[model samples]
Target: MSLREVIAQMRQTMASLGGEAAVLLQRLAARAIRGELRRLAGAGSRVWTPAAARAVVDRLRRMLVRLVAQLGAALGKALTSAAATSLADAALFFETGDRALLGHVLPLRPVAPTPAQIALAREGVFKASLGRFGALLVHAVEGAAVATVLLGKPHRAGVDHVALALRRTAAAHAWELQRIAETEASAAYNAAQLEVLLAQDVPGDRMMKRLVATFDSRTGRDSVLLHGQVRPVREPFFDSHRGHFYMAPPNRPNDRELMVGHRPAWGEVVVDRWPVAEDRRAAPAPAATRRVPGQAIRSAKNLRAGDVLAAPGRPRIASVAERGGRIEVRTEQGLLLYFAAGAAIGVLAAS
Candidate 1:
């Protein structure tokens, strides 16, 4: 098919999803405008008037228009280049203010990758490097072998280090790609979104009104107990900065158990647990151990494997083990709280 036809079809496909995007984008605009109006009225008034509602509705209408234009421009650019295909697909699919599209069309944005996200992204970079560089290495090795045999050249009988060079180059490339992806996928868009909001004379922080997340996920012993099964989101995911926080497990940042502070843009019940609010009430300030009071210990000297311990506001230390020359306290919540020798830790009594 002609490139023109491809672009046309792409535009049509985007249009079909435009309704969904419109609903989300318009809601976002209404929120931003309402936030501005509220602030302009001074003294944090909680009042809502019909006039204000109309104003928000009007902004919503404008948002739909902006979305259409954004789609047209973005699709055009994405198809025009090969590298941008991923970003285009990403931006189109999300249809939320959270998307870090280079276009910077919407306002509300959460903070970028948590440490967990960074790790996952690095993994992605490494995988991408393996696929691209691994193949190149095979061909290069074959070429070198062929050249050596064909030329009747003396076997260098030395460590050529070609593989090492490629490996190091791959590592460098992986790092650079990861850094680029983080910025393009998150930081740049977040900053641009906030910039646009501020330039439009709105209170950027306040208009970032929604902190999505719900009662979900198996937050290890370290997190707040959700109901008997789950709990509300307010205490766990919501963040004063970037609107919400995302937590990934400390061990390794994988996509499966991401902790995010936001909800779905369209308000659907999520089946995927990839992004959750594993607030775990986030280690509730580690005070006294309610389960076994006065058991808190000061040093790792007495800790031993298979020793069960308890601490207030923390999950019971399910077990103690030596790891990396330190005492690793494995919490019931699946957290690895490491204590160094002679370090002061909360009271801990063998459970």
Candidate 2:
């Protein structure tokens, strides 16, 4: 098949899979929230008064509403940049019939859960529990009088009945609170899984196999292979926290290296050459201006701060750095570029 035809087929397949996955995740999240609420409400039925039960139900309603909104936002944001790139790279591999390109495109590792995600989960559970307790307490005192009236007892004797009711209500509330905490933790972990998926890295080997199978079926070819034997080298001076890797090319000099996948041993490297396109825009330029061992030049409007530049003889990759009127270009290997403003320099895109 033609490269364009292959790319079109790949795009269609990826869109279908990504959309299906998204819908499934949304449904699962909705079901989980509903199930938790139902369980809490069922437990609340043991309370002495209807008002107390209603309060518990109402609190659950609010919690679910907030959780849905937060999750929607998170999922939307995750699908945009990193997730999109991963899908595109897989498509590119189909287009070129190159497996080495997979190294640059395929995610090699699953990122560990971030501290922020952990904190968010803990905070969500804590707040949900506190809200449940408050709702129960608000109706606890009124429950006592209602219990007494229903019991047909003297006012002093009714105090004992109210006490007994309170004890039962508290115990039920505690149990429900624990259930909510567990549900929240599960939801958090599921959301994390979704994040990993959106980031273009499937969680387990089984899922990876499924992904490869889908790709092969869509392309009418079984050429694709997943390699788990290779280790990925970390890209230096980049965000190690994100665990980015440089999948080394066989013949390309080290400075022309690609920051493609995440963790290593996740897959095999296929193609060595970076693809360039006229329609594609460069990734968002880096914001910080730092000094490297590169030559300095005057700034120009066409020059972006993070645009990678290559000269005729230099195999090293140089990045544009702008500070006021001065523009400095430096490479990771400490090479400098000395050029005049508006010099006809070639701009390279990140693969």
Q: Please report the candidate that would top TM-score against the real structure.
A: 2
**Among all candidates shown, the one with the greatest lDDT:** 2
lDDT of 2 by residue, 182-287 (tens): 3333233323333443344434432211111122212211111111112212211221111122222111111111122323243433231222122222223223
Models 1 onward score TM values of: 0.22, 0.27
- Candidate 1 lDDT, 66-167, residue by residue in tens: 533443333223222311232343233334323432323443343343323333333443345324533443444334333333333222211122223323
TM-score of 2: 0.27
**How close is each model in CA RMSD to the real structure?**
25.4, 16.8
lDDT of each: 0.33, 0.37
Model 1: ten consecutive residues of lowest lDDT? 249-258
Cα error, residue 12 of model 1, in Å, equals 20
lDDT of 1 at 247: 27
Q: Which ranges of candidate 1 are over 4 A from the true structure? A: 1-159, 168-176, 202-351
Clashing pairs for predicted structure model 2, backbone only: 99-270, 100-269, 100-270, 100-271, 101-271, 109-263, 294-336, 295-336, 295-337
Q: For model 1, what is the alpha-carbon lDDT of residue 171?
A: 42
Task: Provide the lDDT at 188 for model 1.
Answer: 23
